[model samples]
Target: MEIVTRADRPDLRETAAAVFKERWPEFVFHDEVPRRYTDRAEKYFGLFDIMVLDHGSVVAGGWGVPVPWNGAVGDLPSGYDAALVRAVEAREADIPATTLSFMAAAVGESHDKRGLATVVLQELTRRARDQGLAHVIAPLRPTWKHRYPTVPMDEYAGWTRPDGLSIDPWIRTHQRMGARVLGTAPRSMVIEGTVAEWESWTEMVFPVTGEYVIPGALNLVRIDVEQDHGVYVEENLWVQHR
Candidate 1:
């Protein structure tokens, strides 16, 4: 398997997109903030988007953007949405970014458990180091958090195994790679849609207005049938790599 940047291998863009769509939940594609900047980020910072391919078939991918950071955990962007915004704004204003904030990483379903995620992350970090960035951070979406949607992210992020590693597989992977948890972003990514849209995304019925747990959701989705709206606010843990 070989890893390459999207900029250098634009031919793999379609393969990478298929990997992401297959791994991520359908609702994840509806976030307005990311939808607005994703194209721009790719157009400007394509070097930061990396893909792993096995015999020229995409197996894994990761993407991030450079942002100006103060080197303080408390000053980090509120979450993924804010970080993307900061990156775009900084580029437009001619401000040099000091950090690389990872946005998303995914391994194709057929290639799970092959350590491709670690490979993708390592490549991202290597790229950041080569660029002279001071820090590499990720607003991580815990792999197991969706199973415990009612739990607060701050509390969930604190859960550890007997070996002192994170309980969530995704966070544990980062921890094993020398990344330390910084904090929780309670409102990392927000998804809002009409009641009908929510039902279609989850393939579950939302007959009345109330909080309902849906598959692949890390938090409760509030549905207000009377208002014809449903909203989901996701939380993510912030981790900084050494």
Candidate 2:
């Protein structure tokens, strides 16, 4: 498969959206808040920030945004929400972007084990380097974290395999690609909605006020039945590439 940007083919918006929907179900509930900024980013940067395919089906995609950075260690935004907020601010203020922040990367189900994720990262970094950006950072939502939603992010991030690599395959991929884990973004992305909304999204019943492991949630969702609200705060790892 070949990677193509929106600049190359402006009519692939629906194709890109379909890929996102397939890979990220949670986005259905929480993307509205950040969609405005991401849409603006696409407008300003063209499809340069979006990675799709041409001539063949898109088996992988990467999404990112350019943001102003101070070139200091530990200065990246905490997570996806904060990172996107900064990106929006920079764009609105006409501040030149100094770094590229990768928000999401995914390989189609049938394309797994083909190393498409590595290819996506290489393309993103090459794009950033071509644009004269200093580095690329990611708020990585580990692929396997959803399996153990009750584990604290700090503990999960610290997990290591027998070979001394990350237990999470996704994090291990970043590490192998030369990214260093800075820390955990405890409140990377927050989704809050009514009980009815959560029920519809997860297709599960929340009868009382407490944290429940809803389907597809990266972390337990806190449901306040009396208040008719549910909140999900996802955790992610802050990885930096130099």
Candidate 3:
């Protein structure tokens, strides 16, 4: 299998979109009006490098990640995007230079085992390093990711890491790709522990969040979402060392 990384390639990137479509079906947004991560990725990924390959007869594969700080953490409305830009402008020093916020990489199932995911990630790290991006970061909500129903849009931004292994594998994946765990700050929902502990805590604590709801809006909605009802998603925030 051959791997190639790039800054931008419209033709190849267009083909790569097919993989993303499978991973992030349009139905996700069609079923839910707000259109989740894939929506954002499709809308904006054109601005970044699109890594992919056309592997002969089998299936084509590719993945895309943003430059620096382009991640739409959760429910990134225009205002939130604007605010984040402003914040970056205001505190350049506080946020590390190599902080690279990532979006999801769209890959095809047929292309599995070809090391396509690993290749794309390696390419992304190289490109990020070239651009002086210190780390590749991905921030996703545990609610949408951990099979929890969507957190109220209003409070969604404030929702921290919900406890569990919802995102640990991803971080470990990044570490495998050559990044360090600078820190794991507690978000409103996340917890730190072993796999067994994660399972137990998820069962025990997920329901409790409902009490904090405001009663009328989204917060009031039951977060005790049936695991089967929603799809499971995890955010992978990574920082690849130069």
**Best prediction by TM-score:** 1
lDDT of each: 0.92, 0.80, 0.39
Candidates, ranked, TM-score: 1, 2, 3
Per-residue alpha-carbon lDDT of candidate 3 for residues 129-225, written as tens digits (9 for 90 to 100): 6766655654322224323334333343334346522243444455456654322222222112332332342333343323322211112223333
Better of 1 and 3 by lDDT: 1
Deviation in Å, model 2, residue 87 alpha carbon:
1.0
In candidate 3, residue 67 scores what lDDT? 36
* Residue 176's lDDT in candidate 3: 59
Error of 2 at 57 (Å): 1.6
lDDT of 2 by residue, 1-242 (tens): 67887567657666766676777665344655585676776676654455546356666788788888786646767689888888888888988999888888877777789888898888889888999998788889888888889998878988999898899999999999999987888778888899998888888899989999876667998999999998888888888886
User: Of the pair 1 and 2, which is ahead by lDDT?
Assistant: 1
lDDT (0-100) at residue 208 of candidate 3? Answer: 33
lDDT of 1 by residue, 1-242 (tens): 98888888988888889988986789989999988887888888988899998998999999999999998988999899999999998998999999999999999999999999999899999989999999999999999999999999999998999999988999999988999999998788999999999999999999989999999999999999999999999999999999
In model 3, how large is the Cα lDDT of residue 136?
60
